[model samples]
Target chain A: MKAATPTGANIALFLAGLLFGLGLAVSGMINPAKVIGFLDLAGAWDPTLILVMGGGLALTLPAFHFILKRPAPLYGQKFHLPTLTQIDGKLIAGASLFGVGWGIAGFCPGPALAALVTLNSSVLLFVAAMLAGMALHRLLLE
Target chain B: MENFTPITGLIGGLLIGCAAVLTLWASGRIAGISGILSGLLFPHKTDTGWRALFIGGILIGAACFAWFNGGVTIEIQTSPGLTVIAGLLVGFGTRLGSGCTSGHGICGIGRLSRRSFTATATFMFVAIVTVYLTRHVLGGNL
Candidate 1:
Protein backbone atom coordinates (compact mmCIF):
# COMPACT_ATOMS: atom_id res chain seq x y z
CA MET A 1 0.00 0.00 0.00
CA LYS A 2 1.17 3.51 -0.72
CA ALA A 3 1.88 5.73 2.23
CA ALA A 4 -0.49 8.60 2.61
CA THR A 5 0.76 12.17 2.91
CA PRO A 6 -0.12 13.67 6.27
CA THR A 7 -3.01 16.13 6.48
CA GLY A 8 -0.73 18.57 8.25
CA ALA A 9 1.50 18.62 5.22
CA ASN A 10 -1.43 19.56 3.03
CA ILE A 11 -2.43 22.33 5.39
CA ALA A 12 1.08 23.72 5.42
CA LEU A 13 1.17 23.66 1.64
CA PHE A 14 -2.13 25.53 1.52
CA LEU A 15 -0.81 28.21 3.81
CA ALA A 16 2.36 28.57 1.80
CA GLY A 17 0.40 28.89 -1.43
CA LEU A 18 -1.87 31.46 0.17
CA LEU A 19 1.08 33.56 1.23
CA PHE A 20 2.62 33.23 -2.21
CA GLY A 21 -0.54 34.37 -3.96
CA LEU A 22 -1.00 37.19 -1.49
CA GLY A 23 2.51 38.35 -2.16
CA LEU A 24 1.94 38.28 -5.89
CA ALA A 25 -1.23 40.31 -5.50
CA VAL A 26 0.25 42.83 -3.09
CA SER A 27 3.28 43.37 -5.31
CA GLY A 28 1.13 44.42 -8.27
CA MET A 29 2.15 41.27 -10.13
CA ILE A 30 -1.49 40.34 -10.52
CA ASN A 31 -1.83 43.25 -12.86
CA PRO A 32 -1.17 42.25 -16.46
CA ALA A 33 -0.84 45.89 -17.35
CA LYS A 34 2.16 46.13 -15.09
CA VAL A 35 3.62 43.00 -16.68
CA ILE A 36 3.00 44.45 -20.12
CA GLY A 37 4.60 47.67 -19.06
CA PHE A 38 7.68 45.82 -17.96
CA LEU A 39 7.81 43.99 -21.27
CA ASP A 40 7.22 47.17 -23.26
CA LEU A 41 10.81 48.31 -23.23
CA ALA A 42 10.59 50.49 -26.33
CA GLY A 43 7.52 52.26 -25.09
CA ALA A 44 7.38 53.08 -21.35
CA TRP A 45 9.52 50.51 -19.58
CA ASP A 46 8.71 49.55 -16.00
CA PRO A 47 11.65 47.73 -14.46
CA THR A 48 10.01 47.21 -11.09
CA LEU A 49 9.52 43.50 -11.79
CA ILE A 50 13.29 43.11 -11.91
CA LEU A 51 13.38 44.37 -8.35
CA VAL A 52 10.63 41.96 -7.40
CA MET A 53 12.47 39.01 -8.96
CA GLY A 54 15.68 40.24 -7.33
CA GLY A 55 14.09 40.48 -3.92
CA GLY A 56 12.75 36.96 -4.17
CA LEU A 57 16.20 35.70 -5.16
CA ALA A 58 17.97 37.63 -2.39
CA LEU A 59 15.97 36.00 0.41
CA THR A 60 15.66 32.55 -1.14
CA LEU A 61 19.40 32.33 -1.83
CA PRO A 62 20.33 32.07 1.83
CA ALA A 63 17.23 30.21 2.94
CA PHE A 64 17.64 27.39 0.40
CA HIS A 65 21.21 26.72 1.54
CA PHE A 66 20.13 26.61 5.16
CA ILE A 67 17.25 24.27 4.44
CA LEU A 68 19.34 21.93 2.32
CA LYS A 69 21.71 21.46 5.24
CA ARG A 70 18.94 19.65 7.11
CA PRO A 71 18.77 15.85 6.93
CA ALA A 72 15.29 15.92 5.45
CA PRO A 73 12.28 18.14 5.20
CA LEU A 74 10.34 18.71 8.42
CA TYR A 75 7.24 16.85 7.25
CA GLY A 76 8.33 14.78 4.25
CA GLN A 77 10.60 11.80 3.85
CA LYS A 78 13.10 13.43 1.51
CA PHE A 79 13.88 16.59 -0.38
CA HIS A 80 12.08 16.14 -3.71
CA LEU A 81 14.66 17.84 -5.86
CA PRO A 82 14.63 17.94 -9.65
CA THR A 83 17.07 15.46 -11.17
CA LEU A 84 17.20 16.70 -14.75
CA THR A 85 20.15 19.01 -15.24
CA GLN A 86 20.68 18.96 -18.96
CA ILE A 87 20.10 21.86 -21.31
CA ASP A 88 18.32 20.24 -24.24
CA GLY A 89 16.07 20.90 -27.20
CA LYS A 90 12.92 20.35 -25.15
CA LEU A 91 13.95 22.96 -22.65
CA ILE A 92 14.75 25.50 -25.32
CA ALA A 93 11.58 24.88 -27.31
CA GLY A 94 9.38 24.88 -24.25
CA ALA A 95 10.94 28.03 -22.89
CA SER A 96 10.49 29.80 -26.16
CA LEU A 97 6.86 28.80 -26.41
CA PHE A 98 6.17 29.85 -22.84
CA GLY A 99 7.94 33.15 -23.34
CA VAL A 100 5.90 34.00 -26.37
CA GLY A 101 2.74 33.20 -24.50
CA TRP A 102 3.80 35.26 -21.51
CA GLY A 103 4.71 38.22 -23.66
CA ILE A 104 1.41 38.04 -25.47
CA ALA A 105 -0.79 37.64 -22.40
CA GLY A 106 1.27 39.10 -19.55
CA PHE A 107 0.31 36.25 -17.25
CA CYS A 108 2.04 33.14 -15.99
CA PRO A 109 0.51 30.28 -14.01
CA GLY A 110 0.91 31.94 -10.61
CA PRO A 111 -0.27 35.42 -11.44
CA ALA A 112 -2.97 34.07 -13.71
CA LEU A 113 -4.31 31.92 -10.89
CA ALA A 114 -4.14 34.90 -8.54
CA ALA A 115 -5.85 37.13 -11.08
CA LEU A 116 -8.73 34.63 -11.18
CA VAL A 117 -10.17 36.40 -8.15
CA THR A 118 -11.17 39.34 -10.33
CA LEU A 119 -13.36 37.09 -12.53
CA ASN A 120 -12.49 39.01 -15.64
CA SER A 121 -13.96 37.53 -18.81
CA SER A 122 -10.61 37.42 -20.56
CA VAL A 123 -9.03 35.69 -17.57
CA LEU A 124 -11.73 33.10 -17.61
CA LEU A 125 -11.24 32.47 -21.29
CA PHE A 126 -7.51 32.25 -20.89
CA VAL A 127 -7.71 29.82 -17.98
CA ALA A 128 -10.15 27.64 -19.83
CA ALA A 129 -7.85 27.47 -22.79
CA MET A 130 -4.93 26.79 -20.53
CA LEU A 131 -6.65 23.84 -18.92
CA ALA A 132 -7.54 22.50 -22.32
CA GLY A 133 -3.95 22.77 -23.37
CA MET A 134 -2.81 20.90 -20.30
CA ALA A 135 -5.33 18.19 -21.03
CA LEU A 136 -4.12 17.96 -24.59
CA HIS A 137 -0.54 17.66 -23.45
CA ARG A 138 -1.54 14.85 -21.14
CA LEU A 139 -3.34 13.07 -23.94
CA LEU A 140 -0.75 13.48 -26.65
CA LEU A 141 2.54 13.57 -24.80
CA GLU A 142 1.97 11.66 -21.61
CA MET B 1 2.52 53.80 -17.04
CA GLU B 2 2.69 55.50 -13.65
CA ASN B 3 1.51 52.49 -11.62
CA PHE B 4 4.92 51.01 -10.92
CA THR B 5 5.53 50.47 -7.19
CA PRO B 6 9.05 49.16 -6.52
CA ILE B 7 8.96 49.16 -2.72
CA THR B 8 5.82 47.06 -2.57
CA GLY B 9 7.21 44.94 -5.37
CA LEU B 10 10.30 44.15 -3.36
CA ILE B 11 8.32 43.49 -0.22
CA GLY B 12 5.90 41.23 -2.06
CA GLY B 13 8.77 39.33 -3.65
CA LEU B 14 10.36 38.77 -0.25
CA LEU B 15 7.09 37.37 0.98
CA ILE B 16 7.00 35.05 -2.01
CA GLY B 17 10.54 33.94 -1.23
CA CYS B 18 9.57 33.30 2.36
CA ALA B 19 6.66 31.20 1.22
CA ALA B 20 8.91 29.27 -1.14
CA VAL B 21 11.42 28.65 1.65
CA LEU B 22 8.70 27.62 4.07
CA THR B 23 7.33 25.09 1.61
CA LEU B 24 10.75 23.61 0.97
CA TRP B 25 11.68 23.50 4.65
CA ALA B 26 8.36 22.00 5.62
CA SER B 27 7.53 19.74 2.67
CA GLY B 28 10.76 19.51 0.67
CA ARG B 29 8.86 20.68 -2.39
CA ILE B 30 9.84 23.47 -4.72
CA ALA B 31 7.02 25.98 -4.91
CA GLY B 32 6.52 25.70 -8.62
CA ILE B 33 3.00 26.72 -9.56
CA SER B 34 2.96 24.87 -12.87
CA GLY B 35 4.16 21.63 -11.31
CA ILE B 36 1.70 21.91 -8.44
CA LEU B 37 -1.28 22.69 -10.65
CA SER B 38 -0.35 19.96 -13.13
CA GLY B 39 -0.14 17.44 -10.33
CA LEU B 40 -3.77 18.14 -9.56
CA LEU B 41 -4.81 17.49 -13.13
CA PHE B 42 -2.53 14.46 -13.51
CA PRO B 43 -3.18 13.03 -10.01
CA HIS B 44 -0.47 11.31 -8.03
CA LYS B 45 -1.73 9.20 -5.13
CA THR B 46 0.66 10.64 -2.56
CA ASP B 47 0.59 14.09 -4.13
CA THR B 48 -3.10 14.83 -4.67
CA GLY B 49 -4.05 16.11 -1.25
CA TRP B 50 -1.33 18.73 -0.88
CA ARG B 51 -1.71 19.77 -4.49
CA ALA B 52 -5.42 20.40 -4.06
CA LEU B 53 -4.93 22.36 -0.88
CA PHE B 54 -2.13 24.47 -2.29
CA ILE B 55 -4.28 25.41 -5.25
CA GLY B 56 -7.19 26.06 -2.94
CA GLY B 57 -5.00 28.25 -0.81
CA ILE B 58 -3.98 30.26 -3.83
CA LEU B 59 -7.65 30.84 -4.63
CA ILE B 60 -8.38 31.79 -1.07
CA GLY B 61 -5.46 34.16 -1.06
CA ALA B 62 -6.81 35.74 -4.19
CA ALA B 63 -10.10 36.16 -2.42
CA CYS B 64 -8.37 37.86 0.46
CA PHE B 65 -6.67 40.20 -1.95
CA ALA B 66 -10.04 40.93 -3.45
CA TRP B 67 -11.37 41.68 0.02
CA PHE B 68 -8.62 43.73 1.61
CA ASN B 69 -6.26 44.93 -1.12
CA GLY B 70 -8.94 47.07 -2.76
CA GLY B 71 -9.69 44.19 -5.11
CA VAL B 72 -7.41 42.96 -7.89
CA THR B 73 -7.26 45.00 -11.03
CA ILE B 74 -6.96 42.53 -13.93
CA GLU B 75 -6.15 44.51 -16.99
CA ILE B 76 -5.71 42.38 -20.10
CA GLN B 77 -5.31 44.69 -23.06
CA THR B 78 -5.78 41.89 -25.57
CA SER B 79 -8.83 40.40 -27.18
CA PRO B 80 -10.37 37.27 -25.75
CA GLY B 81 -9.20 35.23 -28.72
CA LEU B 82 -5.58 36.23 -28.30
CA THR B 83 -5.77 35.68 -24.58
CA VAL B 84 -6.98 32.14 -25.11
CA ILE B 85 -4.16 31.37 -27.51
CA ALA B 86 -1.63 32.70 -25.06
CA GLY B 87 -3.10 30.61 -22.28
CA LEU B 88 -2.99 27.42 -24.33
CA LEU B 89 0.60 28.01 -25.28
CA VAL B 90 1.57 28.73 -21.66
CA GLY B 91 -0.03 25.55 -20.40
CA PHE B 92 1.49 23.33 -23.05
CA GLY B 93 4.88 25.00 -22.94
CA THR B 94 5.23 24.96 -19.18
CA ARG B 95 4.44 21.27 -18.98
CA LEU B 96 6.84 20.40 -21.79
CA GLY B 97 9.50 22.67 -20.32
CA SER B 98 8.99 21.22 -16.81
CA GLY B 99 8.90 24.73 -15.26
CA CYS B 100 8.16 28.39 -15.69
CA THR B 101 9.27 31.80 -14.39
CA SER B 102 8.86 30.82 -10.76
CA GLY B 103 10.23 27.34 -11.12
CA HIS B 104 13.25 27.98 -13.32
CA GLY B 105 13.68 31.72 -12.86
CA ILE B 106 13.36 31.97 -9.10
CA CYS B 107 13.85 28.64 -7.30
CA GLY B 108 16.04 26.90 -9.85
CA ILE B 109 18.38 29.86 -10.31
CA GLY B 110 18.55 30.39 -6.55
CA ARG B 111 19.92 26.87 -6.23
CA LEU B 112 22.51 27.66 -8.92
CA SER B 113 21.04 25.05 -11.21
CA ARG B 114 22.57 25.42 -14.67
CA ARG B 115 19.54 23.94 -16.43
CA SER B 116 17.36 26.61 -14.90
CA PHE B 117 19.84 29.30 -15.82
CA THR B 118 19.75 28.26 -19.44
CA ALA B 119 15.99 27.92 -19.44
CA THR B 120 15.62 31.33 -17.84
CA ALA B 121 17.92 32.95 -20.34
CA THR B 122 16.12 31.29 -23.23
CA PHE B 123 12.69 32.36 -22.10
CA MET B 124 13.67 35.90 -21.24
CA PHE B 125 15.40 36.32 -24.56
CA VAL B 126 12.44 34.95 -26.47
CA ALA B 127 9.99 37.06 -24.49
CA ILE B 128 11.95 40.23 -25.20
CA VAL B 129 12.15 39.38 -28.85
CA THR B 130 8.45 38.54 -29.03
CA VAL B 131 7.53 41.78 -27.33
CA TYR B 132 9.67 43.78 -29.69
CA LEU B 133 8.24 42.08 -32.72
CA THR B 134 4.69 42.59 -31.59
CA ARG B 135 5.01 46.13 -30.27
CA HIS B 136 7.53 47.63 -32.64
CA VAL B 137 7.72 45.62 -35.83
CA LEU B 138 4.20 44.36 -36.22
CA GLY B 139 2.51 47.44 -34.74
CA GLY B 140 0.40 45.11 -32.66
CA ASN B 141 -1.43 46.08 -29.47
CA LEU B 142 -1.57 43.16 -27.05
Candidate 2:
Protein backbone atom coordinates (compact mmCIF):
# COMPACT_ATOMS: atom_id res chain seq x y z
CA MET A 1 0.00 0.00 0.00
CA LYS A 2 2.97 2.32 -0.33
CA ALA A 3 3.17 4.94 -3.04
CA ALA A 4 4.73 4.39 -6.50
CA THR A 5 8.37 3.41 -6.74
CA PRO A 6 10.67 4.47 -9.56
CA THR A 7 13.99 2.92 -8.60
CA GLY A 8 13.89 0.15 -11.16
CA ALA A 9 12.32 2.40 -13.74
CA ASN A 10 15.02 5.02 -13.31
CA ILE A 11 17.80 2.49 -13.59
CA ALA A 12 16.15 1.01 -16.65
CA LEU A 13 15.96 4.46 -18.24
CA PHE A 14 19.54 5.37 -17.40
CA LEU A 15 20.83 2.05 -18.66
CA ALA A 16 18.77 2.46 -21.77
CA GLY A 17 20.37 5.84 -22.42
CA LEU A 18 23.81 4.54 -21.59
CA LEU A 19 23.46 1.53 -23.84
CA PHE A 20 21.99 3.70 -26.53
CA GLY A 21 24.96 6.02 -26.32
CA LEU A 22 27.30 3.07 -26.27
CA GLY A 23 25.64 1.56 -29.29
CA LEU A 24 26.14 4.86 -31.05
CA ALA A 25 29.77 5.05 -29.99
CA VAL A 26 30.63 1.37 -30.51
CA SER A 27 28.74 1.05 -33.79
CA GLY A 28 29.97 4.50 -34.82
CA MET A 29 26.48 5.92 -34.97
CA ILE A 30 27.65 8.91 -32.93
CA ASN A 31 29.75 9.92 -35.88
CA PRO A 32 28.18 12.87 -37.64
CA ALA A 33 28.88 11.43 -41.04
CA LYS A 34 27.12 8.18 -40.20
CA VAL A 35 24.09 10.04 -38.88
CA ILE A 36 24.11 12.45 -41.77
CA GLY A 37 24.49 9.52 -44.07
CA PHE A 38 21.32 8.07 -42.67
CA LEU A 39 19.62 11.36 -43.43
CA ASP A 40 21.23 11.63 -46.82
CA LEU A 41 18.84 10.54 -49.52
CA ALA A 42 21.12 11.23 -52.48
CA GLY A 43 24.46 9.90 -51.25
CA ALA A 44 26.07 6.48 -50.69
CA TRP A 45 23.63 6.13 -47.78
CA ASP A 46 25.53 3.76 -45.53
CA PRO A 47 22.70 1.92 -43.84
CA THR A 48 24.90 0.21 -41.29
CA LEU A 49 23.46 2.27 -38.44
CA ILE A 50 20.01 1.21 -39.51
CA LEU A 51 21.14 -2.36 -39.11
CA VAL A 52 22.26 -1.61 -35.55
CA MET A 53 18.91 -0.09 -34.70
CA GLY A 54 17.07 -2.92 -36.41
CA GLY A 55 19.07 -5.45 -34.46
CA GLY A 56 18.20 -3.69 -31.24
CA LEU A 57 14.51 -3.66 -32.13
CA ALA A 58 14.56 -7.34 -33.00
CA LEU A 59 15.96 -8.16 -29.58
CA THR A 60 13.58 -5.86 -27.79
CA LEU A 61 10.20 -7.12 -29.07
CA PRO A 62 10.14 -10.68 -27.79
CA ALA A 63 11.48 -9.98 -24.32
CA PHE A 64 8.94 -7.23 -23.66
CA HIS A 65 6.10 -9.58 -24.61
CA PHE A 66 7.07 -12.13 -21.98
CA ILE A 67 7.93 -9.59 -19.30
CA LEU A 68 4.68 -7.60 -19.29
CA LYS A 69 2.43 -10.51 -18.41
CA ARG A 70 3.94 -11.22 -15.01
CA PRO A 71 1.80 -10.54 -11.93
CA ALA A 72 4.28 -8.44 -9.97
CA PRO A 73 7.56 -6.91 -11.01
CA LEU A 74 10.79 -7.20 -9.06
CA TYR A 75 11.25 -3.52 -8.13
CA GLY A 76 7.80 -1.99 -7.84
CA GLN A 77 4.15 -2.78 -7.27
CA LYS A 78 2.42 -2.36 -10.67
CA PHE A 79 3.14 -1.68 -14.33
CA HIS A 80 3.14 2.05 -15.15
CA LEU A 81 2.97 1.76 -18.91
CA PRO A 82 1.09 4.53 -20.73
CA THR A 83 -2.20 3.78 -22.51
CA LEU A 84 -2.85 6.72 -24.86
CA THR A 85 -2.72 6.06 -28.63
CA GLN A 86 -2.78 8.74 -31.29
CA ILE A 87 -0.61 11.07 -33.38
CA ASP A 88 -0.86 14.81 -32.95
CA GLY A 89 0.79 18.23 -33.33
CA LYS A 90 2.85 17.82 -30.19
CA LEU A 91 4.55 14.81 -31.72
CA ILE A 92 5.39 16.67 -34.90
CA ALA A 93 6.84 19.64 -33.06
CA GLY A 94 8.97 17.69 -30.62
CA ALA A 95 10.32 15.33 -33.28
CA SER A 96 11.22 18.24 -35.52
CA LEU A 97 13.12 19.97 -32.75
CA PHE A 98 14.92 16.82 -31.71
CA GLY A 99 15.89 16.07 -35.32
CA VAL A 100 17.19 19.56 -35.94
CA GLY A 101 19.32 19.41 -32.82
CA TRP A 102 20.60 15.96 -33.69
CA GLY A 103 21.41 16.83 -37.27
CA ILE A 104 23.18 20.05 -36.37
CA ALA A 105 25.23 18.81 -33.42
CA GLY A 106 25.73 15.20 -34.46
CA PHE A 107 25.23 14.52 -30.77
CA CYS A 108 22.07 13.29 -29.20
CA PRO A 109 21.71 14.08 -25.47
CA GLY A 110 22.82 10.66 -24.23
CA PRO A 111 25.68 10.54 -26.70
CA ALA A 112 26.48 14.19 -26.26
CA LEU A 113 26.66 13.69 -22.53
CA ALA A 114 28.77 10.57 -23.01
CA ALA A 115 30.88 12.30 -25.62
CA LEU A 116 31.82 14.81 -22.93
CA VAL A 117 34.35 12.23 -21.76
CA THR A 118 36.51 13.29 -24.69
CA LEU A 119 37.27 16.48 -22.71
CA ASN A 120 36.90 18.84 -25.62
CA SER A 121 35.80 22.41 -24.95
CA SER A 122 33.06 22.10 -27.54
CA VAL A 123 31.61 19.09 -25.79
CA LEU A 124 31.85 20.81 -22.47
CA LEU A 125 30.15 23.86 -23.82
CA PHE A 126 27.38 21.81 -25.27
CA VAL A 127 26.84 20.00 -22.01
CA ALA A 128 26.84 23.29 -20.16
CA ALA A 129 24.36 24.79 -22.55
CA MET A 130 22.29 21.69 -22.28
CA LEU A 131 22.25 22.10 -18.54
CA ALA A 132 21.38 25.73 -19.00
CA GLY A 133 18.51 24.76 -21.25
CA MET A 134 17.24 22.41 -18.61
CA ALA A 135 17.59 25.07 -15.96
CA LEU A 136 15.77 27.61 -18.04
CA HIS A 137 12.92 25.21 -18.58
CA ARG A 138 12.75 24.42 -14.91
CA LEU A 139 12.76 28.07 -13.94
CA LEU A 140 9.86 28.62 -16.27
CA LEU A 141 8.11 25.61 -14.77
CA GLU A 142 7.65 23.94 -18.13
CA MET B 1 16.95 -6.64 -41.72
CA GLU B 2 18.42 -10.07 -42.45
CA ASN B 3 21.80 -11.75 -42.10
CA PHE B 4 22.62 -9.83 -39.00
CA THR B 5 24.75 -11.87 -36.62
CA PRO B 6 26.51 -9.29 -34.49
CA ILE B 7 26.13 -10.60 -30.95
CA THR B 8 26.86 -7.13 -29.63
CA GLY B 9 23.81 -5.75 -31.35
CA LEU B 10 21.37 -8.42 -30.22
CA ILE B 11 22.78 -8.93 -26.78
CA GLY B 12 23.03 -5.23 -26.12
CA GLY B 13 19.44 -4.70 -27.15
CA LEU B 14 18.23 -7.64 -25.13
CA LEU B 15 20.05 -6.46 -22.07
CA ILE B 16 18.71 -2.93 -22.30
CA GLY B 17 15.22 -4.13 -23.16
CA CYS B 18 15.24 -6.60 -20.32
CA ALA B 19 16.42 -3.88 -17.98
CA ALA B 20 13.58 -1.63 -19.04
CA VAL B 21 11.03 -4.43 -18.59
CA LEU B 22 12.37 -5.40 -15.21
CA THR B 23 12.39 -1.83 -13.99
CA LEU B 24 8.81 -1.49 -15.12
CA TRP B 25 7.95 -4.76 -13.42
CA ALA B 26 9.75 -3.79 -10.24
CA SER B 27 8.82 -0.11 -10.04
CA GLY B 28 5.38 -0.28 -11.63
CA ARG B 29 6.46 2.70 -13.69
CA ILE B 30 7.41 3.29 -17.27
CA ALA B 31 11.10 3.89 -17.84
CA GLY B 32 10.48 7.32 -19.29
CA ILE B 33 13.50 9.62 -19.36
CA SER B 34 11.41 12.76 -19.34
CA GLY B 35 9.34 11.80 -16.32
CA ILE B 36 12.34 10.68 -14.33
CA LEU B 37 14.09 13.90 -15.28
CA SER B 38 11.08 15.97 -14.36
CA GLY B 39 10.83 14.23 -11.06
CA LEU B 40 14.42 15.10 -10.38
CA LEU B 41 13.71 18.68 -11.32
CA PHE B 42 10.32 19.21 -9.66
CA PRO B 43 11.21 17.35 -6.49
CA HIS B 44 7.71 16.64 -5.23
CA LYS B 45 8.23 12.88 -5.31
CA THR B 46 10.14 10.90 -2.70
CA ASP B 47 11.58 7.95 -4.64
CA THR B 48 15.06 8.47 -6.00
CA GLY B 49 16.55 5.00 -6.31
CA TRP B 50 15.87 4.67 -10.03
CA ARG B 51 17.20 8.12 -10.77
CA ALA B 52 20.47 7.54 -9.00
CA LEU B 53 20.91 4.13 -10.55
CA PHE B 54 20.03 5.46 -13.96
CA ILE B 55 22.58 8.28 -13.84
CA GLY B 56 25.21 5.99 -12.40
CA GLY B 57 24.49 3.38 -15.01
CA ILE B 58 24.91 5.97 -17.75
CA LEU B 59 28.36 6.90 -16.52
CA ILE B 60 29.43 3.29 -16.15
CA GLY B 61 27.90 2.39 -19.46
CA ALA B 62 29.70 5.23 -21.19
CA ALA B 63 32.98 3.97 -19.82
CA CYS B 64 32.05 0.50 -21.01
CA PHE B 65 31.47 1.84 -24.49
CA ALA B 66 34.95 3.29 -24.58
CA TRP B 67 36.36 0.12 -23.10
CA PHE B 68 34.60 -2.19 -25.52
CA ASN B 69 35.49 0.03 -28.45
CA GLY B 70 39.12 0.48 -27.43
CA GLY B 71 38.43 4.10 -26.54
CA VAL B 72 35.35 5.45 -28.27
CA THR B 73 36.79 7.21 -31.32
CA ILE B 74 35.27 10.61 -30.72
CA GLU B 75 35.88 13.89 -32.53
CA ILE B 76 34.52 17.30 -31.72
CA GLN B 77 33.47 19.02 -34.89
CA THR B 78 31.24 21.63 -33.27
CA SER B 79 31.86 24.39 -30.77
CA PRO B 80 31.20 23.53 -27.12
CA GLY B 81 29.03 26.61 -26.72
CA LEU B 82 26.80 25.57 -29.57
CA THR B 83 26.51 22.03 -28.32
CA VAL B 84 25.51 23.24 -24.87
CA ILE B 85 22.91 25.47 -26.42
CA ALA B 86 21.57 22.49 -28.33
CA GLY B 87 21.33 20.55 -25.10
CA LEU B 88 19.29 23.32 -23.58
CA LEU B 89 16.87 23.25 -26.47
CA VAL B 90 16.41 19.53 -26.09
CA GLY B 91 15.88 19.90 -22.37
CA PHE B 92 13.34 22.57 -23.01
CA GLY B 93 11.54 20.45 -25.56
CA THR B 94 11.58 17.49 -23.23
CA ARG B 95 10.02 19.57 -20.48
CA LEU B 96 7.40 21.25 -22.63
CA GLY B 97 6.41 18.02 -24.27
CA SER B 98 6.01 16.23 -20.94
CA GLY B 99 8.28 13.28 -21.86
CA CYS B 100 11.36 12.23 -23.74
CA THR B 101 11.53 9.82 -26.65
CA SER B 102 12.20 6.82 -24.41
CA GLY B 103 9.11 7.29 -22.33
CA HIS B 104 6.78 8.00 -25.20
CA GLY B 105 8.37 6.04 -28.03
CA ILE B 106 9.52 2.91 -26.24
CA CYS B 107 7.47 2.38 -23.09
CA GLY B 108 4.40 4.43 -23.90
CA ILE B 109 3.95 3.03 -27.39
CA GLY B 110 4.68 -0.46 -26.15
CA ARG B 111 1.86 -0.12 -23.62
CA LEU B 112 -0.45 1.40 -26.24
CA SER B 113 -0.89 4.75 -24.55
CA ARG B 114 -2.69 7.20 -26.81
CA ARG B 115 -0.69 10.07 -25.38
CA SER B 116 2.54 8.20 -25.92
CA PHE B 117 1.60 7.26 -29.48
CA THR B 118 0.96 10.88 -30.25
CA ALA B 119 4.03 11.99 -28.39
CA THR B 120 6.32 9.43 -29.99
CA ALA B 121 4.99 10.09 -33.45
CA THR B 122 5.31 13.80 -32.87
CA PHE B 123 8.82 13.53 -31.50
CA MET B 124 9.89 11.45 -34.50
CA PHE B 125 8.38 13.79 -37.00
CA VAL B 126 9.81 16.78 -35.22
CA ALA B 127 13.18 15.12 -35.22
CA ILE B 128 13.04 14.31 -38.93
CA VAL B 129 11.76 17.66 -40.10
CA THR B 130 14.04 19.59 -37.80
CA VAL B 131 17.01 17.72 -39.20
CA TYR B 132 15.86 18.51 -42.68
CA LEU B 133 15.47 22.21 -41.98
CA THR B 134 18.63 22.63 -39.96
CA ARG B 135 20.78 20.74 -42.43
CA HIS B 136 18.97 21.69 -45.59
CA VAL B 137 17.39 25.09 -45.03
CA LEU B 138 19.38 26.61 -42.20
CA GLY B 139 22.40 24.78 -43.58
CA GLY B 140 23.21 24.00 -39.97
CA ASN B 141 25.11 27.26 -40.07
CA LEU B 142 25.25 27.25 -36.32
Q: Each model's RMSD to truth, in Å?
A: 1.4, 4.2
The parts of candidate 2 lying over 4 Å away from their true place are A1-24, A83-91, B1-15, B42-45, B136-141
TM-score of chain B of each: 0.92, 0.78
lDDT of 2 by residue, B6-109 (tens): 55544544444454555565566665555565555545445565565665565577678777667765655555556665677766666555566556555555
Give the CA lDDT, 0 to 100, for residue B19 in model 1.
Answer: 77
Query: Which ten contiguous residues of candidate 1 chain B have the minimum total lDDT?
Result: B69-78
Report the CAPRI category for model 1.
medium
Candidate 1 lDDT over residue span B16-126, tens digit each: 888788788888888888888888887877768888888888888878978986777777777888888899988988888889888888888888889889888887888
Badly placed stretches (over 4 Å) of model 1 are: none
Most accurate candidate by TM-score: 1
Q: Evaluated with DockQ, which candidate comes out highest?
A: 1
